[model samples]
Target: MARIKALVFDVFGTLVDWRTSIARESEQALTPLGIAVDWLAFADAWRDQYQPAMEEVRAGRIPFCKLDCLHRRNLDVVLADLGLDQLNEATRQQLNLAWHRLDAWPDVSAGLHALRQHYRLAPCSNGNISLMVDLARRNDFPWDAILGAEVARDYKPKPTVYLSAADAFDLRPDEVMMVAAHSSDLAAAAEAGLRTAFIARPDEYGPGLGESAATVPVDVSAGSLIALAQALSTANTPP
Candidate 1:
């Protein structure tokens, strides 16, 4: 096997607690406007629109746009669904930025710090560059660069997104490992000829609603980023 020279990550559920973070952010943003809804359900409802919106771009029904634009569009749909479409443009815009303020998982910072000692690191998230930058700054993520859907002009599961990230680092696909909580994502990366690692985020959707393990086989599987770092470190160590 080619030595892994870089590690790219899936940001939303893999590194950050998007469900709880979005719930908290939504309540904070909407409560002041007298909106009363189950915040977690609201978060889920908003997220449910994510894939379909991306599918529009992937299927060529729409031009490729940044995730921020897709997020804003999804936010409008969510607001309308909840009868909160009366919100002013400025308020909606501010609320749409909630994705940027998501909190990272507890193990992320230190684990990434450890991994950085051995390999180049960057986020291969579907999130736009600005969104990734905001999350990185807010969480102190040590990314070498922001390379993902925005950089590739395409979303994940598309071969270009993974290959583009590898190209950005000037590494062969086999020299890069795609770490994610979603098996589907890892499967896609493996199909694109990148190494794959899986870390389950059991509460990503809610209590026990997320994946407990990779449904597909992977090169490495661990419960947390710290453990993943340890596993990779050991595997790459000299005899």
Candidate 2:
């Protein structure tokens, strides 16, 4: 196998707990308005539209838009469905940015630090640059550079999105590992000639709703980012 030189990650479910964080923040933001829907369900409903919204751009039905814009549109639809559409613009904007404040998983900070010792790290997410930067600061993720959807003007599992990340580091596809909890994301990266690492995130969608394993084989599979880091460190150590 070619030596891996860098690591690019999937942000939402892979590194951050989007469901729990969004639900918590949404409840905090919406409680003032007396809108008492199931916040977790509300989060799921909003996320349910994620891929389809990206598909619109991917298929040329809409031009490229940041994930924040797509998230705002998705938020409005959910609010309308919940019959709580009376929220003012400021409130809606705050709620829309819930994605920006998502907390990293417990293992992420240390794991990324460890991996950063041996490889460059960045988020190759569908999230735009500003969103990724905000999340990185919020979570203290140490990334070498930001590269993903906005940079490519496209979303994953699009080939351009994956290839663009590799190009950003001036590295060949196989020299950078695409680390994600989602099998399809890794599959797309594999198709683009990048190496793959699957880190299981079984609670990404709220207990048991996330994937525990990759649907296909990957170059590495671990229970968390820390495990991946340890495995890689061990592999690189000389006898």
Listed in order, each prediction's TM-score against the native is 0.98, 0.98
Cα lDDT of all candidates, in order?
A: 0.94, 0.93
Candidate 1, residue 34: CA error in Å?
1.1
User: Can you write out model 1's per-residue Cα lDDT over 1-239, one digit (the tens) per residue?
Assistant: 33899999999999999999989999998899888899999999999999999999999999999999999999999988888879999998998899999999999999999999989999999999999999999999999999999999999889999999999999999999999999999999999999999998999998899999999989999999999989987887788
Task: Give the clashing pairs for model 1.
Answer: none
Q: Residue-wise lDDT of candidate 2 within 61-97, one digit each (tens)?
A: 9999999999999989988887887899999998899
Query: What CA root-mean-square deviation does each model show from the true structure?
Result: 0.9, 1.0
Best model per lDDT: 1
